[model samples]
Target: MQRVKPGDGRALKRFRWWQSLSRALFHLRLMDGDSGQTVYSVDVRHQQHSSSSGRVVAHLYLDGRHHAESTVPAVFPVQGGTVEVRASTVGLKRCHYVTAEGAEFQLVPDPASAEGRRARLDRSHPALSRCMGFLSGTVLVVGVVLLALQLAEQITRDPEGVAQYAGTLTSPIDLSGWANTVVGLCTVAASTERALRLRYNWLLDGAAG
Candidate 1:
């Protein structure tokens, strides 16, 4: 991680209502023994419209002032621990403080952000939250299975000489154009829902994204 020079004195930008779709903020607090408590915040702006590289930067703030900034996955040294930040295509995938002894704590999302709203829902309605999570996973699973079947059918449709080595295989389920479009839409929604909770899987969510 690149460290911003000390005394740089850059101010952290205030979160705007419109930027909620493309920005994220999270906070962490730690006790500093005799010094009492210390506060740290992380701010990330999505680079979807700004950069071709698709990489976003995470800014670390001490108390409420800008301390350092680095392109994620970023690790910033803090009191008694390090703040780790990572981002996915749709949203954040990780933001936690790792202690010297290996303990990890997720930073609290800003109440105005989408992630914070999701976390609030999880706290207020655990059962509904669980059901939603299950639904997201099921949708992704169905999407992946359908994708695999479609690919198999396409490959086997024109096997050519390869049919001799591996017999042609056909997909059992055939989806109409509209049905496929629906599935694609659902997959995107599921991935977005998972992203709001900072939940990501390399195979399932990765493929969906």
Candidate 2:
């Protein structure tokens, strides 16, 4: 009969790395506003019956809700990278945008979230500037053509009102007025849109949109 030795190959550590199964790791991040986007992250590890000093993975919970058990992996697991999880505020009276684990990290610590908004006058100003250049060029071309046609028609025969009207509309004074007006209009529209969106975002996270 063969005799087994003490602490031999038959003896094994229950939580040994070799004996543990590979598990999916994860982390967490949360949003603090209406968009419910990710704002923060947490590190965690597998919830297995092993050494407490094993690999680290993230554990997640949505808005203080019991979304998962203690051993369940988070939505975005990461071994040595960043995790992304949203702070869900659904089914609450006036959702408070907050992470399930931490405080707010706003754009400047005023309230708790970033004001994802752009100044209207600043927003469409560039586009208007670019479009103004284009429209100016179009007007120049049309004006030149009209001027040439009018000159030819008048120089050879009786002149008509079409040339004058075309010239006036494409003139420097008219073009400048139109460009400025267009820029102002677009600036207003873009700025308003940015403001509205930002306000909605702020209501939840308590920051400027």
Candidate 3:
């Protein structure tokens, strides 16, 4: 973790309405025993054009002031625990406060952001949220299956050398150009929805990414 230099008095910028789609802000409040409560915030800007290396950095804020900044996945020490932050191609994959005793708690998302809206939906309509989550997973699974079949068909198209080892294989489903494009769009949408909830699986979401 990179600490904010003492003399570097840069302040945390306010979250703008237009940046909701490309930015994430999360907050965690912890009780410091007899010392009372402490608040920590994690901020990430997904579209940082100035970052030549294309790495997303997470900024740590203490009680609304700039405290530290680090390239994710980052871990910033706090009063009682550490704030862990991670980002993905679409958005943040993880943002949690982990106590020294190993207890983990997800930080609260800023109400104005996309992630916050999705989380609000989950809380207000749990059944509907669950249905949406199921649909997203199903879509991703279908996409991966179709991709695997297409890859297999391509590999076995010219199986002259490998014919002796294994029989030629063919894809059961052959989608047209427009149909494949539709599927691709659906997969992207599904992945984006999952990202809003900070849900990611190396196999399912990774393929979409």
TM-score of each: 0.88, 0.17, 0.90
Error of 1 at 140 (Å): 0.7
Cα RMSD to native, each candidate?
2.4, 23.0, 2.3
- Provide the lDDT at 153 for model 1: 72
Off by over 4 Å in 1: 2-8, 48-54
Q: What 10-residue stretch in candidate 2 is worst by lDDT?
A: 87-96
Give me the candidate number with maximum TM-score.
3
TM-score: model 1 vs. ground truth: 0.88
lDDT by residue (1-209, candidate 1, tens digit) is 46333424477677777877799999998888887888898988885332543457788888888887777788898998799988877888899999999999999998888888899999999999999999999999999999988887777776575555677877889899999999999998899899889899998888887
Residue 203 lDDT (model 1): 87
User: Candidate 3: minimum summed lDDT over ten consecutive residues — where?
Assistant: 1-10
Pairwise TM-score winner, candidates 2 and 3: 3
Local accuracy of candidate 3 as per-residue lDDT tens digits, 1-209:
55322223367677778987789999988887876887888889987622644678778887778888777788888887788887888888899989999999899999888888899999999999999999999999999999988877777667575544676777779899999999999998999899899999989988888
For residue 35, what is the lDDT in candidate 1? 78
Cα lDDT over the full model 2: 0.30
Question: What is residue 192's positional error in candidate 1, in angstroms?
Answer: 1.4
